[model samples]
Target chain A: MNRQVLLFYPLLGMILLGLFIGGLAYGAVPIPLDHVVDILLGKGSDKIAWQNIVLQSRLPQAITALLAGASLATSGLLLQTLFRNPLAGPSILGISDGANLGVAAIMLYFGGTLGQFADWPISGYMAVILAAFAGACAILGLIIYFSAKVKNNVMLLIIGIMIGYLASSVISILNYYSSTDRVHAFVMWGLGNFSGVSLEQLPFLGSCTLAGLLLAILLIKPLNALLLGEMYAANLGIHIKRTRILILLCTGILTATTTAFCGPISFIGLAVPHIARLMLGSSNHKMLVPVTVLTGSCIALLCNMLMVVPGSNMILPLNAVTPMLGAPVIIYVIVNRKNIQYFN
Target chain B: MAMKQTSVIKTSDLSIGYTLKGGRKKCVHDALNLSLYPGEVTCLLGLNGAGKSTLLRTLCGFQPPLGGKIELMGKPLSSYSQGSFSRMVGVVLTEKTNAGGITVYELASLGRHPYTGFFGQLRQEDHRIIEESLIAAGIAHKAHNYVSELSDGERQKAMIAKALAQQCPIILLDEPTAFLDVTSRIETMVLLHKLAVEQQKAILLSTHDLDLAIQLGDCLWLQEKGRPMACGTPEDLILGGAFETFFSKEGIVFDPGTGKLHTEAPTVPVGVEGDLTTSYWVGNALIRNGFKPSLVSEEYVSVCCNAPNDLRILFPVGDMRIAESIAEMVSIIVHKS
Candidate 1:
């Protein structure tokens, strides 16, 4: 490992600490930094409301941001490598759109009654997560099937976009026929909120995202080989079919978990890897994967912080904030297209 | 020359083809048997649509043979795992892959994946192999440069180096020199020849440059229409008139004299005499002027010069002027004779 990368660990650590502290102290109820530290250390005032607000509300939201960032970023890196497309991200395969469609179907067609069924013993967060997983997997499965048939990367990308359009169209129809209350609930979910996931649901979200991350790590070797191309990866002894399936699964899980919790936050999975690649100046995957994960976490944390700027009551939607960060990197990559070499 | 060593690749009545699944199914090519020997360079020669690449892919075990069997080092190609198969045969494909922002060193290290542990960490021996392969391919200096920065020739070298680092017994290259310049083509051929001779690896390559193929390869696999014929030395093939049969067409005769195709031309003047050395140049000049040169005695030159001829001029310039044409020589020859 390079000494510079080793040096980055402490800096990233400090930034994470600062972000965590800032996330706890800078919310709507603006607790003092000392009180925030005391609450974290279990030494704050013995007030139920304060404890609930700090532990349940802000901490879960911040952790959600951190995990979502890492998961989306890792998902983006995997997709980019697997597809051999710089612009490829989680949504490129329509996984997020698939998740959106699932949420829309449940909220609109099944009515807002579906979300209120969280109290049902078997169908609470598990139901929503499963729904999101199935939806994302459906799109991922289609993408994988098409990927096997269509050897061209750009053509596969177009197909993925078309799939996204189809899913969006389906969601639009559901929204059109639904009642006003259902539409209101679906629209709010569409706005994208990291704070929507409760503390009780955090464990499930965290475990699923972690599993996706582990799978992504397991794919590092094949991903590195894939950076050459599928044929080259096959030449390097990677089972292309199995590797593609694993990638789709990982992408499905990561995107599904994020969508289930945060409601299909866009651009993080598509942009963070590019940012990491630009920062690292290499695509070895051994380095790029880890850096992208950390950078995703950092970016997500930053965006979460930005969503609730201090002294401002108006909080921006996380989706709106992500595009503000992600779109410029994409446009820069496009505008300076010739300067960037995609394949050797 | 057949060595007594173990064969790295053997095809037994192998009919290689791709099965296209649609409303109705079809196979690309019928079964064919081919064997690749250790420590030899086998050049596959064929026209554009002769299924040469398809054959190579099938032989490398990327695609299963439509019929028959392919054995790698006496084991069925399909029997080995992908990692073991990769370790047995390294392939350099014709298309440039997605190398993008990867350095030459990183790309070369990927060749060692079959040997690495779970995380694909490089051992010291792996590093040594990578360094040696880089030096062998003459791309050591470009180790840190992104593969995207290398020229087509350099990139090809790097790719070959990656295969070398893999240290496979069989190396299959598809049109290795297809996009290279003349110098790069020669260098790549020479490199492959060296690899076969020194590393003792069996190298199978497909190429359109028949001349270089004939010059460098130890054997030739010529695909004509649906049939494939293997030949020994290029000289033997030529002597056997195999090339004539393969490339025969109107206005194109394979010239035995130059070992190349040349158009047949009409004969020129004859019976001109001079010193053998100067006569060579004089003969070339005569041929350019649509005249043929023939050797005769020094006395016959004067007789022929006096006789009527088309058009002839004497050599050795100013002092010596010999006439050999219908106008002046005819009168002189009639009087002298």
Candidate 2:
């Protein structure tokens, strides 16, 4: 890399360290910086509540932010390449909305019954995760099936938006009939949070994200070929059908896992790839993929830090913080539309 | 160059067209048989919508023939894998690329994918071929420039260079001069001819520029709707009335006198004599001055020179520049005969 990327690494390192410290220091119950470091090193005082807050609660939240950021950003990059559209992303494909619809149906219509059966066979969290996973896979399968039929990228984008609207309408009908308590629970989940995913579930969630990211990396060659166009990619001997299916599957897994744990976080998946391209000034996936991953992690960590600002009693929602960072980039792309070269 | 080689492409009983689901077929051409020899430029000529592009596509294995067999070299066209088939035959399509920020060299290097490994690593031979192909197409100086910055003619050359870098034995181009100006059209035709002759490759190109095609091609594959014809030379097609039958519509005629097409009547004095060769040039001069040239049995030089005062001047090679009177015209004609 270049000297700028080299400098960015150390700067990102320091920012990551600061965010970790801030995550431990500024939760609902504030811990001193020295005590936070002590708790991290396993040398804290005899305050059991501080240990619980620092070790169990804050650390997993911070790691989840980092992983979710990187996973969603990489997912955005791969989708953009596969579809050859600058505006394509995980949420735009209806994968995230599919997961949201799954969660809404479960929480609004089947919330009380699922909790009643929590001790019998499956837990409520497991049921929600399974429902989200199935919903995500269903939409991904549909997108892949249609990708073979639709040769134009812009048409596929319009189809994806239509799917999202269809899923949203279904969720609205479910919300209208549900009881007040269940609706309240669904509404709380819709607010979006990184604190819901416990440390015990992090390994499974993290590995699934990693697996999807690895598949995306394996597809870099075909992605580069696809940057020109599908016909050009086909001329280069890439099996276009199989490659598009793989991209859908990977984007589905990443989007579903993040939406299962945290509610639908918008704009990161749609905006981060463009940010990475602007920063790197290259469309080559070999460099773009890693840069998007890191930039995503940094942005997510920054958002997490801003959520629990210093000397604040009320915590900001994660979704509320993302638009502030993502909307400007979208506007910048629109304003400089004449200058931005997308596919190639 | 290789000589007396086997046919590079062979089509037997080819009935190619689009087949609908209900057993109805809109056949472009039916029951055709032809062989393309190596080191020859075969030009396919036709009026609009005469299935010239369809034939090229069918031969390249992009579209399947309704009832026929196509063999490249010795093996069947369908028997080869897509990768191997692409390696054997390069194609320059008429489709325009809308991609931006792609460099000319980067676009040309995509042709090396067949020889490159799975990850598309460019080998030394691949680099050499790319450089040589760029030089051959006269776009080596534009390797670093973006494709979007190049003019239409330069971009057309770059596209041809990309196909050349594929190093295929057979090349097919569809309407290569469709949007080019006159000079660019001639230059591209000359480049294709050089590739066919110097590289010893089989080249087939479809074009509506019949004048350039007839001048440059070694063989002509003439198609008129369902009727297909082939001739060895341009003169053969002209003599066989293929050009007249296909292109001569109302108000247009192919004149054999000048070997150039014309849209008006010929007007020259009937039976004017002074070595028929020199009289041909005199007739051309009359036609240039808005007077038609017509062949007649009479032996008289009538010049109604309308430039000044309707002053009629008669000229004979025997030294008679008689002027201004019917008596002088008769005297000049008597001396010339």
Candidate 2 DockQ, CA atoms: 0.26
lDDT of 1 by residue, B1-337 (tens): 5445667787787776667766343445565667788788989987787778888988877777878888888989889988888898998997647786888998899999888987899989999999999998889999988888998888888999999999998999999999899999999999999989998989999998888988998888877665556556677777888777665656555544235553444253345544444444444444444444565434333222323333344332222345544445334433433
User: Which residues of candidate 1, in runs, are more than 4 Å off?
Assistant: A45-52, A113-122, A341-344, B2-6, B22-31, B249-256, B259-337
Error of 1 at A291 (Å): 1.1
Clashing residue pairs, backbone N/CA/C < 3 A, model 2: B266-B292, B266-B293, B267-B292, B267-B293, B268-B293, B268-B294, B271-B298
Cα lDDT tens digits for candidate 1, A1-344:
36776676677768777887888878767777888888999886566677778888899999999999999999888888877777777777788999888777766786654346334343655666788888888988888788878978789989999999999999999888988888887788887888877777778888999999999888888998887777778988988989988998998899888887788888898889888877777788877888888889888988998898568787988888999998998888778767775533
lDDT string for model 2 (A147-197, tens) is 778967789988888898999999989989998878776766677777776
Q: Is the docking of candidate 2 incorrect, acceptable, medium or high quality?
A: acceptable
Quality class of the docking in candidate 1, CAPRI style: medium
TM-score of chain A of each: 0.92, 0.89
What TM-score number comes out for model 2? 0.80
For all candidates listed, what's the TM-score of chain B alone?
0.77, 0.81
Task: Give the DockQ (C-alpha) for candidate 1.
Answer: 0.54
